[model samples]
Target: MRYGCFLSEPQGPDAIAGLRDQIAQAVADGFTSAWLSNIFGLDAITALTAAGVQAPPIELGTAVVPTYPRHPAVLAQQAMTANAALGGRFALGIGLSHKMVIENMFGYSFERPGRHMKEYLDILIPASRGEQVDYQGETLKANVRLTAPGAGFPVLVAALGPRMLKLAGTVADGTVLWMTGPKTVAEHVAPTITAAAAEAGRQAPRIVCALPISVTDDPAATVERANEIFKIYGQLPSYRAMLDREGAAGPGDVAIVGDEDTVLARLEELKRAGVTDFVGSVFANRERTRSLLIGAAKG
Candidate 1:
């Protein structure tokens, strides 16, 4: 399994131009990918392409781009364009963001999100493959063909539960998870998705796990800070269910926070538990966390 990291807008000059140096740092540190979460600030794809133009050879992925707001055709065109710009180094990860975010923040009804996702992917996957998708579905319609030269890269879905897992298995390249622990990946996420992929005669799907990482001498203090920063994740229903399945008290409970030895062991557990890619969200002692993860990966 390859190690990766999430690069947010750090508090400095690179914040506005995008963290190209950080991306280079991650690459130099032996990370396979540098992830960007699609949130309020700069658009992930735009930022990724801009950075990838200058940064060395390292994969770039969005933890998720919300599908509720953008149509599949628009997303396909955007992905194709960005992938072309990055010479197909971009992996498009999209999802139906949590109901609270979709309903309350975007003002879109989060009714039957699974079905909506199915409809969205019906057009998205084909469109990404350079096909002319003249498709109509219950929630979406796309009549566009990608004329872009680059073969579009992989599409990883941010899936948590069974339906989405099955969707990722049959259609998407893989599943990208957040706040999901080793236990859930071993017992729930991997099994369900793998079974679906098997039944469909597809290869076993990739499981890209995202979780907080802190290589700290003061583990307790680090966990406390993780709880403070990531508490909101536990309140989201899907994440709450995942936490409950992992028998976790909250987001911090599942986070991989410890000294280097403990963190390395936990990362091994994740790899053994079926995580194909580990995206570390460094919450404290950033360089140490990255160095330890890279060292563990080398080992």
Candidate 2:
């Protein structure tokens, strides 16, 4: 499995410069890829593109950018443009987000998220490849072709459920997961997506799993910190289902925590479970965890 690092939001005055520094560090540390989340802070693709231009080339991707707010065609155009700017090192990861955020916060209909995503892909995939689109589905409509140059970057979906997993496998390049454990990925995630891809006659899909991790002497204290810091994920419907599938009481239960050897063993288990890429979110003991991840990548 390819080892990646989750680029946490940068602090201090110049956030963009800080992000660029982080990317440089990732390259220096010998990581295969680096990811950024897009919830409330910076625009993930734009920020990464800007940062990536300054740093040595390393694969950059959005863990997820919400699809409810942007039109698929526009997003495809933007992503392709960013990819071209970054010398084709960008991957676009999109998701439906949560029902509450879609309806209550963004004032968009969350009635048919699965259908929305399916239709969104109908427009996005072709448009990103510089093909003409004339789709009119139940949830979305697109009738334009993008003028942006096709960089041929992979598109991933933040898919957790069956419908989304099937869509990801059949249509997109892969699925990007968060708050999911190894058991769930082995039994439910990998099998479901791989079957769909096989049925569609597509190449093996990439399953990128991201999880909070810490290399600490005090595992119990780290678990407690994770439970408190990541409490919200346990309440989200999609993540909650994955946690339940893994029989995890909360996000902390699924977090990879322990000494270097233990954490490495857990990562190996994830690789055996068919994870193509692993992104570590160093929640605590940042230096120790990062050193272990870099060593894992190198070793």
TM-score for each of the candidates: 0.96, 0.98
* Residue pairs in candidate 2 whose N, alpha carbon or C atoms collide under 3 angstroms: none
lDDT of 2 at 89: 90
Clashing pairs in 1: none
lDDT of 1 by residue, 165-230 (tens): 999999888999999999999999999998888988988888999999999898888888999999
- Give the per-residue lDDT digits (tens) of candidate 2, residues 1-299: 99999998886679999999999999999999999999888999889988899999999999899998999989998999999999889999899899989999999999878889999999999999988899999878999988887447899999999999999999999999999999999999999999999999999999999999999999999999999999999998989999999999999999999998899999999999999999999999998999999999997
* TM-score of decoy 1: 0.96
Error of 1 at 275 (Å): 0.4
Using TM-score, give the best candidate's number.
2
Measured with C-alpha atoms, the lDDT of residue 76 in candidate 1 is 82
